[model samples]
Target: MAVLRTLLGQALRTTRLSQERTLREVSSAARVSLGYLSEVERGQKEASSELLASICRALGVRLSDVLRDVSETLSVIEPEPAPVLVPVAVPAMAGPGTTAAELRSVRRPVRDVVAAA
Candidate 1:
């Protein structure tokens, strides 16, 4: 997975370009330091939730929308994890027979057979 820095940087760059907003304008609107916002936009630093919220507001987008866009982008780039494996044990039982030897048979897998009286 791409680090949050890279992720946010990509998001910031894309958002800024799409909205035709400069980094300086966005930083002021988001009430963050210009240098800090620049680092975030370059993915050099991780932005806090508050900072992200402010940026989202500046971009005129909701946090959920930003996350959804990120999710879709990540799905396109990331490989799926392997499926989990689980083990199941089947039951074992003695075989049926008329004679003592058959009755005393060791435990074995059940077999489908017709019973006789």
Candidate 2:
């Protein structure tokens, strides 16, 4: 399974590097120790929500944007789920056009809702 912290760390590191900023600069701006920030970037340590916000602020990026990027990365790496068949009660139709066999359940993938997001 893919680790969330690793993805988060990668996204943060990518953002910082794209902006041409050093770890020292971000750590200093975030008021966190340089070693800790480095560890977080390397996926060696988990950062708290507050620390993540601070790091985002230091990097001049939004937390939501970072998370969205991580989510997209995860979707690409994660395996697709099997389709599920759900039974549905079909209402009776009073017309001659009613088809009994066509009122069966539908097969849908589990991640449809997630993919829409």
Candidate 3:
């Protein structure tokens, strides 16, 4: 599964790298611990909304802009697919007649999961 934290981290790291800034500098500006910031950049930890906002401000970037970039990145990484849900009817009793052909597979787009949230 594609993780939102991972994408968010990538966006933050990309912006930081593009600006040629070091973790210590940005962490200091954001008033966040250097170790914690490193963890956030590595996607090992999820930053709270307030922390994210502070990080964005430190990077001189808007939170909305970072979100937009993350959304675009996720879209590219997970292309939309046609909706599909197939159900297979099974007998109540187990028998040798059961076969792989009797099974059905269901597939749905990732957007569905996001929309449900």
Query: What are the models' TM-scores?
Result: 0.67, 0.69, 0.68
Residue by residue across 1-117, what tens digits does model 3's lDDT show? 578998899899999999999999999999999999999988999999999999999999999999999998898889667665534334555367766554432234456655766
> For residues 7-116, what per-residue lDDT tens digits would candidate 1 score against the true structure?
76788779888988888899899998889888988889888888888999998988788778887788888887765333223224433535555443432323311121
Q: Assess each prediction's global lDDT (C-alpha) against the native.
A: 0.74, 0.85, 0.85
- Decoy 1 TM-score against native: 0.67
Cα displacement (angstroms), candidate 3, residue 75, comes to 1.2
List where candidate 2 sits over 4 angstroms from the true fold: 82-117
Q: After superposition, how far is residue 6 of candidate 3 from its true place, in Å?
A: 0.6
Q: Report lDDT (Cα) of residue 99, candidate 3.
A: 65
Clashing pairs in 2: none
Off by over 4 Å in 1: 86-117
Which pairs clash (backbone N, Cα, C closer than 3 Å) in model 1? Answer: none
Listed per candidate, the RMSD to the true structure in angstroms reads 11.0, 6.5, 6.4
